[model samples]
Target: MAKRQVQTTKIDGKRVRIVTTTGANGTRVQVTEAEPKEWELQAAQVRALRGMPEYGKQFLLAGDQNSAKRGPRAQMEASAAGMTPGEADMRIYIAGGQLRMIENKVGRGRLSPAQVDRHAALARMGFTVDVLRAVTTEDAAHQAVALVRGWLAENDNQSGQGQPRCSSTACA
Candidate 1:
């Protein structure tokens, strides 16, 4: 028997670990399971935010295969199909007038380099971007609502209009 060897590598910029062992049968290789990525967790939070009657219909999931699980081949195909990098996770409409983008993050999760670049591009195009992070889903939701309300108010003020009102069906 020979001592086991361990090493780390990166796939798609995410860290992965590999181990190799030698025996009478030659060498065997094993890869450790990667930790759950933040996208799914953040997606669940997005769903929760959308489920709320107050703001549910105002948001739509954006970006590539938001809730779908994909393998390497699928990812390659998506890229080949012209998927844009760093798209915001959610698109939100406020007061039926303003369009905004929301990027959701979970524990210690930060935007990737591509995301940072995309955000800048979108901002240059005069888009509103918001990042939400909180200790709890409820807190995030409240913060999002407050941000939207403030945006609506500011837009109204700039347009020389009074405060915008919310309707039963939409945030008008």
Candidate 2:
């Protein structure tokens, strides 16, 4: 006969354990660090972005913080992707079963045809994309949150219609 394995759900977001076997003395355990999978990271960044205080929010999409040459935005992106500082950046977020992205483009006049096609592809995979042009750190965070606020408001309005409310707090 084959032995069975025991699986355990983790309380923390970052770790999990699977018990492959047990002996007379002790149980064998395998621990896996739950680094945010790409999708989870994307979703968290989006939710963390909601209702952010106005001051630090700008760093979300552009690097304008401090006196550094690239600004907070450039710093954050470089750190997030493990890329060299000063390179351009983008981030995606998913919440309430919706997806959004923040793209820091230096210049723009509406999305290019290729960009639209790419956005459509993301949509097919269940994401709603938003792009923000971040010339600086202030640009990055502020624009990112602003986009989310608007999208969330729209989502709320759509959901509220014809829905029963438990209390006025639900409306708020």
Candidate 3:
């Protein structure tokens, strides 16, 4: 029989559990969190930024609702409805007629395997994808806002001629 061991550690000021079990073959470890505190904080910050009048354009939520607690039936329904795993948290339409995807992470959080695959796929399709991490800090948040503001400024300049420059092939 294998004995299970659990230990607590602080992640971004939140308590997380790391479990380990030793079996005849080897030892296995797992990490879990009581709640995604960091992610939630980052999401709130992102929403605040999105709500700003300067950046209040059309931004769509790409993540699934109640995804973590979804049952098999719900999963099936989502799949049928064309919901994909690892979709970016938000999709924004830039002024220059470009579509951008944003994925938010906080602290030392890294992208899941599915996210990595999806990012690669999107990149291959010529879409711009950006991962915004560590946004819980004011400095990081400000930097992100500045980056988006810069993009908006450039986009505004490009479309200053009354007719917006379309980046899509069908624009002609």
User: For each candidate, what is the lDDT?
Assistant: 0.65, 0.48, 0.65
* lDDT (10s digit) by residue, model 2, range 1-172: 3354866566665446465766665666776643332223333434456446532222233221121356678868756865433221344332334434554453343555656666677778886555555433444556666666676566567666423334447334
Output the number of the TM-score-best candidate.
Answer: 3
- Write one digit per residue (lDDT tens) for candidate 1, span 22-105: 988899998874433455545555666566654544334343444346798987888798766787776765544567787767
TM-score versus the correct structure, for each prediction = 0.53, 0.36, 0.62
Please estimate how well model 1 matches the true structure, expressed as its whole-model Cα lDDT: 0.65
Whole-model lDDT for model 3 versus the true structure?
0.65
Query: Lowest summed-lDDT stretch of 10 residues in model 2?
Result: 58-67
Please give the RMSD to the true structure for each candidate, in Å: 8.8, 19.8, 7.2
- Tell me how far candidate 1 lies from the true structure as C-alpha RMSD in angstroms: 8.8
Candidate 2: stretches off by over 4 Å? 1-95, 107-117, 123-127, 161-172
